[model samples]
Target: MNQTIDTILNHRSIRKFKPEPLKQEHLALILDAARSSSTSSYLMAYTMIGVTDPEKKSALASISNQSYIKDNGHFVLFCGDYHRHMLKADEKEKETLAYNVQSTEYFMIATVDATIAAQNMTLAAESLGIGACYIGSIKRDLDLVNDLFQLPEHVVPLFGLALGYPDEQQEIKPKLPKEAVYFENTYKDDEAHMAALDQFDQTIETYYRTRSTNQREDSWTKQMIKTLHNRRNDRLTPFVKEKKFNNR
Candidate 1:
């Protein structure tokens, strides 16, 4: 297989990082790779905030309750942003032209654009032998995070990316089988879906038991059930609306 494919297949979420900071040239290259990601209709409705200050990182780590956020060489918050577009419209005396920026369609577009860019940045960092972790727990207190960044209207924080040198090697997590995810013209029936889940449960159970760190007797199904049952963060919709997104 090609080196690119190898890199993609061996991906792991790294939470522990070395004390050294990322090289300036590598950081620049990674950011450039993020900018190269495709945007919907060339709108590019997203922004990345690279946090370098130790105080800010400490605040973010508290928000996320993940120490990696503070220890990582670099942290970047990818935001779905339409405020820039609005400013441009106002600048050109064409405020009415960008009236749909708050619509749900535009919100989805910006979110997807930000996600794509973050994935590109992750892949670039991985290719450079740098470790990276996606920090979604920042959403636990979305308002605090927004305030921390001092975001303007029409700019919503989506997630954070922590990049640094690896201090620990983690086992690659197993994913669902190809057959379980990829289907033909029509989606598989309920029986087939259950069969796939059953198979994956066994595989994941084995993985958890065999992994070197945090070994446990659990399956993907159990984890999913627990996660869904305890899902809390009900503020997402309200937060998005407050940011002037998805108003339509």
Candidate 2:
């Protein structure tokens, strides 16, 4: 197998980091690589807030409920930002910033732009021999995080990244079967959806259960049911609507 293919296959999320900090040169290269990623219609509608301060990292950790955020060498909040264009328009011509936001299409474009950039940053960091973990819970309290960072309107936090040299290794978890996901022509669903998923859940449960001495893990279906029934995620849809995307 090719070296690049091997790297891709071996990819895993790394949360524990070495005590050493990243060098300035490596940091600059990662940022440049991320900014070089393709943007929609050249709008470049995204921005990143790099946090090296311990206080700020602690704040993020408290918000994310993930202790690793404070321990990592660096934390970065990637935002889907359209405020730059709005401000520019306001400067050049007197137009309300919401003039084009009535449609949700533009909001989606900015989100895509931000996500692509964040992925580029992750790949670039790993290429530089640094381990990176994505912190998706950064959006849990948009109001709190926004106020913490003093972010302006028209910009939303997509996710965050914690980067540094890895101090520990974690096994790369298995992905679902190709047939369970990949579709050709029109989308095809396995007729026995529950059965197919049950098989996978058993596979995962057995593997982890054998490896650990802790309490037995719940089945995949149980976990999914608990997640959907939980109140934690119910706030997200309402919050997004409040942000003005208005999916309805």
Candidate 3:
């Protein structure tokens, strides 16, 4: 494989990081890679907030309940933002675009745009020998995040990316079989999918039992069951609506 593919294949989430901050040049390169990502119709409805203040990082770590948020060399919150687009329209004397901006379509567009940019940033950081971890817990309390960042309407924090030099190296976790995910022209039958998962469950169980860190006796389906059962984020829809998105 080429160097790019090798980099992509070796991707791992690095939780423990060194105390030193990222170099300014590396940070610039990562942010530039994020900006270079493709956007929907070139709207580029996303904003990245690089958190450097010790107090602010502490607050975010408290909010996320993950000390790595504060301990990392750098933390960046990626936001789905349409506020700038609205400002642009207003500047051009086009006030009628509010309805489209409030539509669920636009909200999805912004979310996708932010996600794409974040992946680009992650790859760039990894290629430069930096470690990174994604913090989805930023959505745990949107209201507090909004107040902490003083986010205006039509802008919502989606997730965060914590980057730093690696303090610990982790094994690359296994993924589902290609047959379970990739289909030629149509999705595989449910029975075949379950069979594939059933076989893969053995591999996952072995992985969990044999991994050096946090070894546990569990299968992917069991973990998925617990995850799905505990997936209760009632604040998400209300918070999104409060940000004036998806009303239509």
Candidate 4:
């Protein structure tokens, strides 16, 4: 397989990192990769806030309840930003669509752009033998995080990324097989889908038994049922709406 495919296939979420920082040039190149990602309609609606300061990182770590946010050599928060576009529209004295409300299309596009940038940075880090982890728990306490980061309107903190040299290696998490995920011209019925899902669940259960960290005696289906039964983050809708994304 090609080196790129090898890097992609061997991906793992690294939680432990060495204290040493990444080289300045390497960090720059990684950021360049992030900037090089494709954006929807050329609207680079994402902002990355790299935090190295002890105080700021500590605050973010508290918010995320993940100590790696403070301990990692670098922590970056990727934000979905439309405020910049609005400011640009003002500069041009052109009337632009008011996306202050929950514009689903705009939110989706911005989120996709941010995700692409994040994945690009992650792959670049992996290629350089650096380890990284995506921190989605930042969304759990959005208000505190927003205040800590001083986010303006139309800017949502989608996720945080922590990067450093590896301190530990982890087993790559198994994914659903192609039979379960990939489809032909038409979508399959419940019977076909459930059969594939059952097989995948068995595979995941075996993987969990063998994994080094947080090993659990459970299948994918059971985990999903447990995790999804309660929509714990009811605040998500209100929080996004408070950020002025409130739209139907």
Q: Best candidate per TM-score, number?
A: 3
Q: Which stretches of candidate 3 lie over 4 Å from their true place?
A: 91-95
| lDDT (tens digit, per residue) of candidate 1 on 111-147 | 9999999999999999999999999998988898888
Indicate the TM-score of model 4.
Answer: 0.93
Clashing pairs in 2: none
User: By summed lDDT, which 10 consecutive residues of candidate 2 come out lowest?
Assistant: 90-99
Pull out the clashing pairs in model 3.
none
lDDT of 4 by residue, 129-233 (tens): 999999998888888888888999888999999999989978888888787888899887667788989998989988888777787799998989988997487
Give lDDT per model, in order. Answer: 0.91, 0.78, 0.91, 0.86
Candidate 2, RMSD to the unseen true structure:
2.6
Task: Please give the TM-score that candidate 2 achieves against the real structure.
Answer: 0.87
For model 3, how does the per-residue alpha-carbon lDDT over 42-88 read when each residue is reduced to its tens digit? Answer: 99999999999999889889888999999988999999998887675
Winner of 1 and 2 under lDDT:
1
By summed lDDT, the worst window of 10 consecutive residues in model 3 runs over: 88-97
